[model samples]
Target: MSTFIAAFLFLLVFFLLMSIGYLIKRKAVQGSCGGLGVLGIEKACDCDEPCDRRKAKDAKEKARQERLAQHRII
Candidate 1:
């Protein structure tokens, strides 16, 4: 039980230090290894033309935004 408590305290202090360092630097949190490019994906939407399903979803989102704008109080 004491050994477990010591290990937990060590890990807690280690992560606290890491968090403070990140806050000081304001660095973006990302994968430890290189981002998705390692898997050959340049981006989520790399295709020149979006697929029909994606197109429909985008259109729906656009329409929703337009409706919200029309009803916005300002």
Candidate 2:
């Protein structure tokens, strides 16, 4: 029937729009990094400062923990 054909066309258009939207969304997702980093996009630091800070903090913590463990062992 004509009604059936119209409905089918409507559904086809709807699905095509949905597919295009999904493709655009997929492309956007692929383009973005999901913001999973220490710095943001604007101030993204590729320098060694953050790495140095992290290493220094880790070393300090390790030294403190080792000192405590040595005391406990005594």
Candidate 3:
């Protein structure tokens, strides 16, 4: 329909303009209210000891880092 095409074009242009503004600013997007920093909390999941899921994620990250380190020639 003509009405639908007009509305779609308007939205497409609006989104393109918003994206251009963001690209010019080059800033990371964050919640409007800030986040854990506002509450003075550090890590998202801060436990005395990490849970199983957290442990696995950490181990995976560690392994990834080690693999990257191994690939380094210098």
State the displacement of the C-alpha of residue 32, model 3, in Å, after optimal TM-score superposition: 3.1
TM-score of each: 0.53, 0.35, 0.44
Query: Which of the predicted structures, 1 or 2, would earn the higher TM-score when compared with the native?
Result: 1
**What are the lDDT figures for the candidates, one per model?**
0.86, 0.71, 0.85
Question: Lowest-lDDT window of 10 residues in candidate 2?
Answer: 27-36
- Top TM-score prediction, candidate number: 1
Identify the runs in model 1 with alpha carbons over 4 angstroms from their true place: 45-47, 51-74
Is 1 or 3 the stronger prediction by TM-score?
A: 1
Could you list the CA RMSD of all candidates, in the order they appear? 7.4, 16.2, 5.9
Compared with the true structure, what per-residue lDDT tens digits does model 1 show for residues 1-74?
99999999999999999899888776656777877788888767778899999889889999998998899665
The whole-model C-alpha lDDT of candidate 3 against the native structure comes to 0.85
What's each prediction's clash count? 0, 0, 0
Deviation (Å) of 16 in candidate 3: 0.6
lDDT of 2 by residue, 1-74 (tens): 99999999999999898789877665332435556353454334555456877679878989998997888633
Indicate the residue-level lDDT of 27 in model 1: 64
Q: Candidate 1, 37: how far from true, in Å?
A: 0.2
Sort by lDDT, best first: 1, 3, 2
lDDT per residue (tens digit) for residues 19-73 in model 3: 9988877655667886887887776886788899999998999999899789965
